[model samples]
Target: MDLIEELMQEITLNNFDVGSSTWVDVTYINNPHSFYVRPTSYRSFLKSMQAHGQKLEQQDLQLSMNIVYYSKTLKNFCRGLIYHVDTAKKNCTCDIYAIDYGCVEKSVSLKNMYSPLLEQGLPPLATHCQLANCEPKNGLWKDKEIDAMKCYIGTEKAKLIVKGKTCLKLIVELFNSCPDDIATMLALTGYSTLGYNENVFSRIPNFKQEKHYYTYPKIEPGNVLHVRTQSGKDLDNFYVAKVDEYYDYINNVNNLLAYSKQAQSLRPEDMKENKAISVFVPQFLRYERGIIQKITVSEEKALVQLVD
Candidate 1:
């Protein structure tokens, strides 16, 4: 079948790969501590997932197995689109960004792309791209991905969980991964595509939405698959690693600035410094309030310092 037909099919462990941009239901887990360590019976888990996918379709939102049809028409020069569906509350949020961004429980100034009108015919799918001329071809895609790109275009990266270990391959699919179910795993809290890091996982606004580009492995008719959420500890570790990485980056920037200053002071023959193209570039120290001040600029690099 063509792409459109695939998106319209009932979601299942085989046909649709579904994940929450925020949280997965924990009602199935008996003990939270042994969350990742224990194996989940694949049979019961698949049944639960299938039920959720069907609920979303009945609500009128169309989900694609892969966003290829939408992304192909959207160009990266513009912003990306992100949509959050609170199935429990039956509410949705949409956002558009020209650069890196994440969403919270609140709303933004952009028009509400989530509409009650899409319940008819073919509904639109989410994408991180924009179509040219604010118009798209008559296809299975939604208008927000094409015409309403003045906001943001967003897509989640995914990961696969199988045999109690994440598949090592770059691209993962569900065990019964069909062309129709393009499941992208989105983590709602402090994590990235690398899985959860407990120390570094922060609840900061833009830092949410950890996309796992994974696929599921097929199971025997009677066998079970233990699919569970990442442990809380792993979530924090992700943040710990991130903060350490930032510190290293800051130190490297300081060293480069010092070298640039020294080279500029040397004699023309000794340093051969090109006045037309200064080596030092200006940058800022970003914080919760945003760019507080410019820390480095050309010859003023030595004046910048970040304190813990």
Candidate 2:
């Protein structure tokens, strides 16, 4: 099948149905935490309020339930799109049924509310298993930096859970292809045809070598393979390149490493003088085809060696 077809199929299978116009009044909310809402679930809740002989407005009734689903699109550039039911809204923020629901919808809309406490419940199936099995502590931010990012990006626990599951799935799927290495596989995922080049993985330096490495003897069905650096450093600098391109990149990095070593040996006197030498560094030393360009360095010390 074509790429579009494949994407459509994936969306059809994984995406949820908030319901149709006939059965549900759906509206999109701006808050990343609660992106969409369906009015159908409110039917029963609305009846309960009326049955109690409480002369509350329909908008008021909707506000009382405050059932809004959080949206996940706003967290990060590559974060997944997710939605969660937010009970605090007491009304759909989209004001979808303004005529039918009235001012109560406006009052209880998510826009007017502060971030609510995520309802404690079992996360969706797609998220629960992956999150439970995550390497770092469950529900804990990977680091203080990540926690700070969450706060700055206005991410809530619900959105984070959604984004985490999405990333995990992407990781799992890319690993399934077994495209020679992580860089090649990542290129296919469109993360970057180029492999990682910077200290992007500084937050989880050992993540690539230890956790993300794809060095399994055999990739069993239902099992994933990962590629990690030998030194347990971050893999964020690695870029995803096509398989064929990665082969060339591998050779280039090897050649550069040899040249770097030769240059260092020749300049032992310069090294003793504490002066940086202008060595002929290949622009594509670490080229991984479309995966990564090169690891550019002006420093005399070479910390990374490109693996063949």
Of the candidates shown, which would achieve the greatest lDDT relative to the real structure?
Answer: 2
Which ten residues in a row are the worst by lDDT in model 1? Answer: 29-38
- Give a tens-digit lDDT track for model 1, residues 1-308: 64324433421122111221211111111111111110122222222111211111324433111011111122221112222223343344322221111111123222233232112222211111111111112323343332222111122222222211111101122211222211211111111122232212123445556332223345579864332221136655521112233323322332232223333342333221122222322332211111113334444432311221
Model 2 lowest lDDT segment of ten: 75-84
**lDDT of all the models against the reference?**
0.23, 0.26
Give the TM-score comparing model 2 with the true structure, all chains together: 0.17
Off by over 4 Å in 1: 1-10, 13-107, 110-114, 120-308
Give all TM-scores, in the order shown. Answer: 0.15, 0.17
lDDT per residue, candidate 2, 1-308, as tens digits?
74334433442343221121112221222211112222333333322221222222334433113232222322111101111223455554332111112111212234432321322111111211111112212323334423322233231112112111121121111111243332333234432233222212222434343231223134468864333122333666543323333322321232232223323243322232222222433542222111112233432443333332
Residue 32 in candidate 2, Cα distance off native in Å: 18
